[model samples]
Target: MEQFEAFLAAHLPSAASFHPHYETSLHQMLLGGGKRFRPALLLGVVQAYNTLLVPSAYHAALAIELLHTYSLIHDDLPAMDNADLRRGMPTLHKMYNEVSAILAGDALNTYAFEVLSNAPFSDKVIVKLVRSLAHNGGVEGMVLGQAIDCHFENQRLELEQVKMLHIHKTGKLIAASLQMGAYIVGRDDLAQQLYDFGIDLGLLFQIQDDILDVTQDETQAGKTTNNDEAKNSFVTLLGYERAMDEANALAEKVTRQMMSFDENLQRELSPTLTQYINRHKD
Candidate 1:
């Protein structure tokens, strides 16, 4: 983790033009500190499969982090969530300007592919990595989910439709994170299983976030809270108690799936997975 952090610090996205705050804004949220959950998932898989490749896998991990950060930056925009806080700090649009925040997000989004391209791997492997990230983070996955989410605000959705919205918006990229790690280590066979687990995990994560949005304060949650009142969030549709039940059930499913993995994979991922698999209770 220390090594990955150092790599991230050294490889932060930068623009060559002499735009005053452009470069600064590009690096701010990345440096501000996030859960780094996606990166951890990728690296943990690589370590489990082949520790020798862990160092090389850092590039993939970093790419995912860059992409995830870009999404967060955009998600906090006034036109989106209208959030004022993120990562325990003022949101980009709040601290600087919405234009700065948007451009920075674009830069980070493109830079994620650039970073992945530079990773020390064969061209074929790089192509696979690129496809996984782009497919999940792009229009077919997260963007589609966001579009549905925003378009459906203030309008109630059926429970299954709500799950579908979150599965596309939040679940796909997370599923890709685990799959990308499988690609890194040439474990395509396990990728599907891991991805399926990650999707459930991601749903649990969103439900938990919805719960936290209403339950935790700004100081405790480190970001805006109670901001989903107008959205078709799980809490809004299922109510808080039902949402908790769903999270608990998903957590149990994730645990069972994790235990069913190859012994070595389970052992390697336990350190990271344990911390997050049941985070709703936290």
Candidate 2:
């Protein structure tokens, strides 16, 4: 994680020369600090396959983090979730202006591809990574999920429908993160298994997020609480206890699947995956 941070600190565009405010906004949001869950998942998969991190893997990790940060910025805009806080700080649109926030997000989104395209991997590997990321982060994945979410505002979604929404919105990119890692290490054979694990992990993560929205305060959650009141969420649709049960069930299933992997792989990944699942418990 420190290495990933250092890599981003060095590579992130400097706001000093051009649009310092815009660049600073980007840096603030990107460096504001979250769990770095997505990149960790990517790097963890690579480390599991090969005991060391590769240059291409680091590039891929940065790409994922950039894309994730972009999503957060946009998701907080007035036109979207109208969120005011992220990572326990004022959101981009709130800190800077909406225009800055939007342009910064756009820059991050495009720059992610640039980083991936210029990775130190072979052309074939880079192409696969780019394709996976585009598919997962673009219309076929997160965007589709966001569209569904916005379209269904104030409309109740069934449990299965909610699962589908999250699978696209929150799960696909996460699944792609694991898949990208497997590709980096030439472990495409593990792609399906890793993606499946990511599905459960993503769902668990979202469910816990939902739980936190209702239970934790801003200080503990590091973001606005009760923000999902108007949105379709696990806690909103299923009630607190049922949502928690679902999360626990998913966690159990994911843990079992992780155990099915080689012991070394399980040891490498369980800690990070466990922290993701148990975050709400804190």
* Per-residue error (Å), model 2, residue 171: 0.6
lDDT of 1 by residue, 1-282 (tens): 889999999998757777778899988899998888889889989988899999999999999999899999999999999999998999999999999999989989999999999999999999999999999999899999999999999999999999999998899999999999999899999889989988898898899889889989999988999999999999999998999999998889889999998888888788887887677788
lDDT of 2 by residue, 101-204 (tens): 99999999999999998898899999999999999999899999999998898999999999999999999999999899999999889888888888888888
Task: Please report the TM-score between candidate 1 and the true structure.
Answer: 0.98
TM-score of each: 0.98, 0.96
In order, what lDDT does every prediction score?
A: 0.91, 0.87
Candidate 1: where are CA atoms >4 Å away? none
Clashing pairs in 1: none
Model 2 lDDT at residue 279: 69
